[model samples]
Structure formats: structure tokens, C-alpha cells
Target: DQQVKQNSPSLSVQEGRISILNCDYTNSMFDYFLWYKKYPAEGPTFLISISSIKDKNEDGRFTVFLNKSAKHLSLHIVPSQPGDSAVYFCAASLRGGADGLTFGKGTHLIIQP
Candidate 1:
């Protein structure tokens, strides 16, 4: 089973519009959630993170909301921009640190003029 899943391979949105991406997890053991944005071949950069202890976390234009009961989470980007066009990955930190993070395939977000 997919521990973390981003069903959409891509998303397109107009500039200055709201962009929402959805994610679901199958494992109840996952407690810490994080989102990473990547461009091309570069490694993903941390966007925002929320502890299982908290329901939501926001940073400026980016926001992450978690629904623990549903085992789901989402990322919201306000006033999407062309610069925001890139791949976004949802990740979950397992109990062991040696494995790093369990990541979804990714969602390629395209922002238009």
C-alpha cells in the first residue's frame, strides 16, 4: 500500500488564484507531516510542516492543514504565481530517522499568466 499518496501528477492554476493540493496517507503511525517544493533536478526544499499534535500550520502564502481523523492533509497556496510552478511533494517522517522521509511521487504545479 502507498504510505503517502498524491493522486494528481500535475495541477494548473492561474496567477493570483488559489491553488490546493490534496494528499492521503494509509498508515496511522505517521505523525509528522511535511511538504517540500522542488524545481527540476534540484532536491526538494522544505515548505512547511505540521506536527500530529497540531491540526494546521501556515507560513505566509503557504498553508498546510491536517485532518488526523481522516488521515488526510492538504496544501494551500494563495495568489499563485508563475514562480511557483514546480513539483510539490508530500512527505511523512517515520519513527526511524535512518530512512529519512517517506515521500509521494510528486505533483507538478503549473502557474499560468
Candidate 2:
């Protein structure tokens, strides 16, 4: 069974607007959440991460929020740009990320002009 899931396969947002990508998990053992961005022909790169203990984490234009009770998390990209158009993967790991991460199917975010 897929422990991590991204229900929306794609999301479109206007350029300079906020882009929100969502993820949900079935595994309660997960304690860390990480977001990764991937462009064509390139490996996924880490964008931001949040711990289960915290509800929110922000870095630059990106922010991540976790709802432990809901087993859900989201990534927000403010003033999204063309460069922000990519596939975003939501990953989870147990116990401060000591073990390997379990990744979602990925959501393709499209920044439109």
C-alpha cells in the first residue's frame, strides 16, 4: 500500500501568485516531512522540511506546514515564478529522518503567466 499520497496529480497557479501543493499520509510513524522539487532531466532537489513537532517552517518563498492529527502537510510557494514550475514530491521519514524516506507520487505544479 502507498503510505504517502498526493491526490492531485497536477496543480496550476498564476505567476506571481501563491502555489499550494498538498500531501497526505497513512503512516502515523512518520515524524518528518520533506518537500523536493524536480525539473526535467534532473534529480529531485530538497526544497524545505518540517518536523512533526512543528506546524510550520518557512524558507525564502517557500513554506511547509504539517497537521499531525490530519496526517497532512502542504507546501506554499508565494509569488510563484516560472522557475517554480516543476514536480513536487512530499516525503516522510520516521524519527528525525534517520531511516529512508517514503515519497508520494508527486504533484506537478505549473506556474502560468
Candidate 3:
């Protein structure tokens, strides 16, 4: 069974708008949450990360929020641009990322003009 799941296969957002990507996890052992963005013909690159102790973490136009009680997390991209269009993968790791991450199927984000 997949421990991590992205309910929406894809999302579309207007340029300069905010794009929110949701992810849910069934595993409570997860303590670290990471968001990765991938473009075609390229490997996934780390975007942002949040620890279980913190509810939110922000980096420039990217932000990650974690809800431990609900076992859910979300990535927010403000002012979405064409360059932001990519596949976003939500990953979780145990022991503060000492172990390997469990990645969700990923959600394709399309930024439209």
C-alpha cells in the first residue's frame, strides 16, 4: 500500500496566482516532510522542507505546511509563473531524514497564462 498519496493527479493555476498542492500520509512515523519539483528530462530537486515540530516553513515564493495530527501537508507557491510549472512530489522521511524518503506519486502543476 502507498503510505503517501496525492489525491489530485494534477492542478492548474493562473499565472501570478497562488498554487496549492496537497499531500496526505498514512504513516505516523514520518517526521520530516519535503517538497520536490521536477521538470521534464530532469531529476527531482528539493524545493522546501518542514520538520514535524514546526507547522510551517517558508522560502521565498515557496512554503510548506505540516499538520501532524491530520498527517497532511501542503506546498504553496505564490505568484505562480511559467517556470513554476512542473511535477511536484511530496516526500516524507523518518528520523529527521536519516532514513530514505517515501514519495507520493506527484502532482503536475500547470501554470497558465
Report the C-alpha lDDT of model 3 over 55-82, residue by residue, as the tens digit: 9999999999888999999999998999
- TM accuracy, model 3: 0.98
Question: Would you give me the overall lDDT of model 2?
Answer: 0.96
Candidate 2: give the clashing pairs: none
Error of 3 at 58 (Å): 0.4
Model 1 Cα lDDT, one tens digit per residue, 1-113: 68999999999999999999989999888878899999987989989988888898999999999999999999999989999999999999765323478899899999999
List ranges where model 3 is wrong by over 4 Å.
Answer: none
Give the Cα lDDT of each candidate: 0.91, 0.96, 0.95
Score candidate 2 by TM-score against the native. Answer: 0.98
**For model 2, the run of ten residues with the poorest summed lDDT:** 94-103
- For candidate 3, the clash count comes to 0
- The residue ranges of model 1 lying beyond 4 angstroms of the native Cα positions read 95-99
TM-score of each: 0.94, 0.98, 0.98
Clashes of 1: 0
Better of 1 and 3 by TM-score: 3
- Determine which window of 10 residues in candidate 1 has minimal summed lDDT: 93-102
